[model samples]
Target: MANVAILELSRNCAKTVEEIVKLERKIFPKHESLASFFHDELKKKNSGLLYLHVDGELAGYVMYSWPSSLYASITKLAVKEQYRGQGHGETLLKAAVEKCRTRKVSRIMLHVDPLRTPAVNLYKKYGFLVDTLIQGYYSSDRDAYRMYRDFDSS
Candidate 1:
C-alpha cells in the first residue's frame, strides 16, 4: 500500500490471521493456519498488539505482544507477497522495538524456523542473538531457533 498506517488490531486481526494462514500454508502443506492463535491471544487480553496496513487491495500485517512481560514475545511478522521489499517489515520491527522499550521489558523473544534463512538473517540484522535451539520445534518437520534481543530498561 502507498499509504502505511499502523492500527491496533481487534477485529481486522481476523483478516490478518487469514493472510498468515495462506502464507504458512505455502510452506506447510497440512498445517493449520495460526489465525486462531492471534484471535485467542487477543481474547486473552494479554499485552499484545498487531499493526496492519492496507496496500490498495492487499494486507500487510505484523503482530507483537508481551512487551511488559518478563520475556516479551514477537509472535509473527508478515508482509504480503507483493508487499515484500517495501521496507514494511523493517518499519514494523522498529515499531515493535519501540513498543518494547516503552513497556520496559528486559528482553524480546522470537522463534525462527531454522530453514528460513532469510528470517534468520533479518533477525541478526536487527541485532537479535541466538539464545538456543529447540529441536523438533515445528510439527511441519522444521526446527526452531530461539532468538532474543536484550534491551536494558534501566
Candidate 2:
C-alpha cells in the first residue's frame, strides 16, 4: 500500500522548493511556469503551497493565495505525469480549497487550460464553475477558462 501525505510548504524550505520547481518546469510551459517566482510567491503573507507525497515520492502540488478575506485563487496545481489518474490532483485541490476555507474566503478561483479535459472535469467535480474565457490567457496560441467555486453555496 502507498503511504500518502500532504505537506504545507514554507518559504524557508529551500530543498523542497527546488524539488517542486523541477517538477513545475517539467509540467508547465516555460512562460506559464511559476518556477522562477515560486520562492518569491511563498514569501507573500497570503500565499502558500501544499505538496503531496506518495510513498515518500513527490506526486503533486498546489499553490494558492488569498489576497483578501473574500477571495482566494489557486495559482497552480500539477501532478507528475506518472501519477496522473491516481487522484493526486484532486487530493491537492481539496487541500488547497480547505486551506482557503480556513481563511474564511467567500470564493476560490483558478484558471485552467480549456484543452485539458481531465483538469476541467476535476474542477467541475469539485464544484467549480466556469466564470469566463480569457483569450490568450496561457499564450498567444492558447486560451484558458477562469473557474470559480463559491463557499457560501456549498
Cα lDDT of model 1 overall?
0.69
Candidate 2's residue-wise lDDT over 84-130, tens digit each? 99999999999999999999889999999999999999999999999
Assess every candidate by TM-score. Answer: 0.79, 0.97
Q: What is each predicted model's overall lDDT from 0 to 1?
A: 0.69, 0.94
Candidate 1 regions exceeding 4 Å error are 11-32, 54-58
**For model 1, how does the per-residue alpha-carbon lDDT over 23-47 read when each residue is reduced to its tens digit?**
6555343443465354565665555
Candidate 1 clash total?
1
User: Residue 37 of candidate 1: its Cα lDDT?
Assistant: 59
**Best-performing candidate as measured by TM-score:** 2
Model 2: which residue pairs collide?
none
In candidate 1, position 10 carries an lDDT of 62
